[model samples]
Target chain A: MNLYLGVDIGSVSSNFILLDQNGRLYRKLYLRTLGNPVKALKDGYASISDGLDKQHGKIRAVGSTGSGRHLAAVLLGADVVKNEITAHAVAASHLFPGAKTIIEIGGQDSKIIILRNNIVHDFAMNTVCAAGTGSFLDQQSARLNIPIQEFGDYAVKSGHPVRIAGRCGVFAESDMIHKQQMGFPVEDIIMGLCEALVRNYLNNVGKGKKIEEPVVFQGGVAANRGLAKAFEKILGLKINVPAHYEVMGAIGAAILAREQMELSHSPTRFRGDNFVLEGNFTSNSHECSGCPNLCEVVCIKRDNEVLAYWGDRCKKWESSIKQPRDRLKVV
Target chain B: MSRVGIPRSLFYYYYYPLWKSFFADLGAEILTSAPSNRHTVERGIELAVDETCFPIKVYLGHVAELCREELDYIFVPRLVSVEARSYICPKFMGLPDMVRALIKETPPLIDITVDLSCDEKCFQKDIIRVGRLFTRQARKIQLAYQHGCEELRLCRSLASQGFTMEEAIKMWEGEPMEAESETDLNIGVLGHGYSLYDERISMNLVKRLRAMNCKVLLPEHLGSEVVEAEAATVPKRVFWTLGRKMLGSALHMSQREDVDGIIYLACFGCGPDSLIGEIIERKVRDNKPFILLTVDEHSGEAGIITRLEAFCDMLRRRRNYRSESKLSPYGASLHSFENTV
Candidate 1:
């Protein structure tokens, strides 16, 4: 009953998942990062490990993904640290075996992955712009005096969605305001905003990509029924949202960890539940004046013991530490 | 003895060997601005006009650094065209005037206009005119120019042996560079020399790839004739010199059996890159994995790392899966989940 753990520490949310030996989801937990990934990761891990008996089995390996993947790997002793794109693609293809396309819109980024025969053929991520992501939806929901959880319900009730500029976030906000001033129905405006975001996602992230069915939509943003419906309307295809869409990245990581452990036959890198629960972690950064680059090198520590160092261009600070496990590898 | 300062930006990556040798042969002490760093980028951003590309802005920063030195002259060449019917970017053509307008209290500039578009006679005359500043010997100037051409050829030849233009230049300057070890992946990286070679501008892209156990294939690795032939397949000739090279190089790389994937580094505001990037994206064939990474002042290293990692993973997975089924190329035998678990 050995279990593999996967953790996805993203910009907005941190998700954890456990996969049994047979590659079935055993347990999952999702928590808001709240601008502090260290706390979110610890809390999520604690919650997932709680109330589990010996019958559930011990963790074998750990895999991490998303924007804070490197940070999570350092803290969690992850066996594999993967990017969000690969993680999402893996999870999508696993859940829906024939999933040819994946539309992943998370807190600050959106991506479209085109898969051929369950293999990722092509992919594109939003470049330098967070025009249509969960963060924007959160901000708009707050401005509209509607809770983000109920935003989809409001959108679905709309008769006609008003047109709003979606090329840029700033422009879209202004257009939303103008539409609001023009006395459009609140539901219609909300639905229109959803439509505009879909348009932006297609034009930017999905540009030149042949998005065939069956398209699987995941990430934290997939929870929004309005956005899901909007994708269906625009792409004119049935979009499948996995039961655990919010934690697909974590699931993918878990699957990868399971695979890695089987291939390498290596012992679990998981530091154990006690290590995560008891370790006192803190990080500090300082500008290195060694040269004109002035790279801001960051040091991560657990109590008094230094764990890792990064951010120097010349690897002066990074290589100074003798810990082979703390070395930053891009993969 | 006359001192001439050369800003280490833009055309410096391409023609630095030629200029250095030319000046040294004429008995002029050559001083190049230090490699680009945070201070250089910041100063350039402040001094340069808002609309110019990042390399041009960096060039201005290098010029500003040159101004700090008590040199007798700074060499800010007005490069219009190097080959017939092919021109450098308009920014290079107006670089001398831009530097003059932006920076005050600068030393005398030997702003030689190098235009070999229609003919090489005027360029030869311009080269001699600049040489006169160091020595009055007409034969000496001609010989210096010949030595410069010879040095340039050596640099290019060194580059074709699998080193970046910057590394080749360093080797040309007698710097000992270790040969890169063989790796599992062969990645074709294409971009303008100034933007791509400058570790700061490209955020150490080539070094990062090498560290990730990849052999980087640069445009310089391909011969000019091969690149030109590939580029000529286009419906219309690319007029921009660097742009043409990029197109030709990308096309050539796409067809190479050894090359796995191609990555194009493009600046956000570059006019030539805006068009050239799209053309390369469309022109690249054989379903070769191509990713156009756009960088600017606001580019974060995290974004770049994520993209690079994903791209590398994609290539590795594709290669592994392809090798597993050599007989049936597109066989459905590999159930990704089952295979992994």
Candidate 2:
């Protein structure tokens, strides 16, 4: 059996997944990136190494995704590097072939991907704040001395969900603490926080976009039943959280790699099996004043012809490929 | 050889010969610009402030065209009224102030005031005061004043005879004219028609100006110079109407650094000049003092001259101030309100 590996190294968390050619998700691990994705990948690899059935299957292709996908690709010698939007969309499309809306909420940020006829129509990302994301809940959980894993279970039991401010991360913490001092029940406060976060998401990040049904909510935050319940209550529809909740980016990445491999007539350019064992590589950036816009650009050069390029509003510095689809390679 | 710049619009038709004779008697030069055109109008609109109206905006355009020549000064005469009771817009009285503020860069401004708004005694005093600035010589001043006065009387009679400018010019050209109109130093002389077409209209503007006994020009003389100079003061290349006016006017005023005053002929209740005349007043008042003559049929020739004489004299005093004082080189910031907006 041939195995395909995918890694998604995001700002807050990292995930690794393995898939078989039959399109089965074989192995997956999701862990906090903790500002150091290289180590997070190693930890994920450690989990994979423990779980590998070495005699039966061999790792054939590797893919990377997320903001730190280039770094992951450089470190793991990924055969494919994809953007987070594409990775998330592909994973959703594969599971629910007619997925219309893919809402991925994570620790630091959230993304809303709109799909039509299995192709991306439009998308929005909430990079400006953490008000509607999982980390907001984490901050509230820390202040309440409630382990986040139990916060959701408590919300499921709440009869009277007390209100708390969740407009901004800094302000929400203070407001949550104030409600706790006022002797509101922990479950109600937690549920209120969940509702506030969902409302914040709908208002700012979800501003000016049509929200259609067949919505798939998958990210690290999908595990929080309380937030899922709050989104359902506000949106007035059933929310689908995929079974591979935490590692969808990874699953998406592996799938994209498989797609690219099928198109590549040449031999695979991925390095070797010991690629993940190699020490981490670093990335750097510089300002390009080539035009009036003066776009500051990031250059991630494993050797130098940018393994990945971003931060240009005009996308002038993005990686190129011999084929147009190869470059615009979604998922 | 008082060459006068009859900026095609306002008082040039009436007063070209009055100024021609006055400056001719003084043996001074007058320069004028070419006639206003689409390009000139565009240039004027580009230079003037945004709020100025069409006619004054166009007047600024003509003056701007005139300022491009290497002339002594472009004449923009200021008049209070032809009659005692009626008056032009307040913008005429304040045009120098307006021009100075809007277009910051340029050469010196020559301003002459007409305070007929007060009385006749004050008007004469103001005239003498303006004359004194030009020269300290009482004898030369009196002679110039006499020549200016006689020329005005003669031109008025000729104007009252109702001779068309073309016929009068044909007749004037027929004689072995003692002193001819200035053909050098082209500039556009702009003002109201009653002021420009009737020599009596601009208070004997042409004869007195022509009496300078120097080269003269009119609005029909503009060309590449105005366009180039006007563009120099603008922030960015904008195709605004008033911007062209202010720019053209500034460029024209800068050329007449030596002119004792600039005379502007603005009409009463003329909406366009209200704001544009203000911009012109602000821009040219400081560097180059100008006279604003607002003309109605009710306009007083005496009052217009009183204003014109005072403006001319103010230019003389401005020269003294310029020489004696530690003058700051005209600090015109190239950046206008236009850039960020």
Candidate 3:
């Protein structure tokens, strides 16, 4: 079997997934990004590569998504680099063919995607708020001295879930403290937090959009059954959580890579194990004062040779790397 | 000649030529503030209140830039209204006062009230009041106003015909229209003139779309009468002049079959736009492919480029799918939206 790889590098977490030629997921791994994407991708790739039995498959094509997609594409020689919106929608519609809506709650950001017949109709992402996302829940779990894995179990056991203000993180935190001081049970407070997150996601990300069923919930936050239950109760529908919920972005990217390869009929630009494992790659950034904007441009290098320059407002620096040999070898 | 500086932020692209010709005809030199850059935005961020919109902050930056020019007077006008019964944003109404309060050691401001809400005579009186500072003759002021109007008419025509502000200004100066080749794809860009026209904030969106072989449409391109008619189709009419114009033009473009998609470039934390944007969203619904890009000073170029690429790819895919399947691509497809039924 031939394997396709997908990597999703977000702010809080980096996900890696491997899929066979038949579009079945073989292996998936979710790891904390911890502010270093290059390290996360390298470590995730190594562990996934080790798990692969020699008789099973060889890596064929690679795709990347999420906010740090460009960095991943440059680091891994991605054949297809896409946004998280497309990747998530693709995976959701693929798994639950009738999924009309997808609510993806990640660590730092959340998004709602409405689909029509397996096509993205409308979508909105959280712009300036990170209150109801996975990071917020993680902070509350740490403060409450409860393991994150057991948070949903506590909420599920609650008979009454209180209403916590979910408009902003600051408001939610203060409200949680106030509720705790007022003698609310820990399970009830946990359930309230889950409800607050669902409400925030609905009002902000799902504002004014038609959110029809069959809805599929995925992302790192979807692991919390408490949040899933709250969403199902508020929306009055059965929310489907796919088996590979945490790494859906990676799965979607892998599916896109397979589609692109089949459509173009080209050989995969995987660069093989030697280039990824043994090659010395170093990245550095500098403020380009070419114009008054003073854009901070990041450049990746392979043994002191510039591979690509990005984050440039005016392509002055990016346009300078114009060697065909370097072009194919780099981006 | 006495020098007067104009900040090139809000309404500069729309009325620059008029003001330029008006000032020049009165024998006064006109200096425009530099185009918005990162330094300008940073200065604005440092000076402006946190609650203000991004464009207003950019305007402050422009004003700060203008302060360095050592002009005799800065032309900061109080634009209350352009048409009868319509108001402008409160920021425009209080801009000159804000400048006076915020910036120290400012040159004398040539503040003029151009409110057409009162009557035509009031507009004439306002112009004449500002004109007296330059010349004492009534005939000279009248002639300058007429010349300004003529130049403005030409600029508006050029802009409506798909010329950018820079291109239109160049055309008004007797230069050839440059690199405006036509493409099959058409995209309607809905936003205030300030956000859509500013290359720095918009990240050169019009040029970027044009480079991808798509014709860009703006609200200013449509006639006011047509826009008003389109706006009346909604339940309640928008009161703000620019807000009404943006909403009207978006509604008009949503009905246009040639327009493949609509991209709304909005300012982050814009109060009026946050409300009107929802209306535009409800109107467009699933009828068209709509993408709302909220831009602020901290918006990253790579992220915007990625979204643009994804949106363009989606439009292309929809076009191909429609042509292949010969099904209606507009609104909810027959195979879609039947889940509830």
Write candidate 3's Cα lDDT for B186-278 as tens digits: 899988878888888888888888866688888877888999998888887788888888888888898899999999988888888898887
- Please write out the lDDT profile of model 1 over residues A1-331, one tens digit for every residue: 7887899999999999988877778889989999999999899988887776678678888899999997888888888788888888888877788889999999998999988877777889998789889999999989989999999999989999999889999999999999999999999998898999999999989888888999999999998899999999988999998899999999888877776766667676678877778999999999999988888889999889887898999988888877545222546
Point out where model 2 deviates above 4 Å.
A49-55, A280-331, B1-341
Estimate how well candidate 2 is docked, as a DockQ score: 0.01
What residue runs in model 3 are displaced by over 4 Å at the alpha carbon?
A51-55, A323-331, B170-184, B211-213, B301-307, B324-341
Candidate 2, residues B145-197, lDDT tens digits: the string is 66766665555444333343422443443542343544322223444343354
Fnat for model 2? 0.00
Alpha-carbon TM-score of each model against the true structure: 0.96, 0.46, 0.92
In terms of docking quality, model 2 is incorrect
Each model's DockQ score: 0.46, 0.01, 0.33
On residues B159-236, what C-alpha lDDT tens digit does candidate 1 reach at each position? 988899899999999998888897999999999999999988998899999987899999898888999999999999
Kindly indicate the candidate among 1 and 3 with the higher DockQ: 1
**A1-331: candidate 3 lDDT, tens digit per residue:** 7888999999889999998877777888999999998888788788888856557788888988888887787677787777787788777877877689999999877889887777777777887678888898889999999998898999999999988998988899899899999999989988998898888888888887788989999999998999999999999988999888888888877877776666568787676666666657789999987777788888988777787897786778877876333223211
Interface RMSD of 1: 5.1
Q: By DockQ, highest first, what's the ranking?
A: 1, 3, 2
TM-score of candidate 2's A chain against the true A chain: 0.84
True contacts kept of each: 0.35, 0.00, 0.18
Q: Report lDDT (Cα) of residue A154, candidate 1.
A: 91
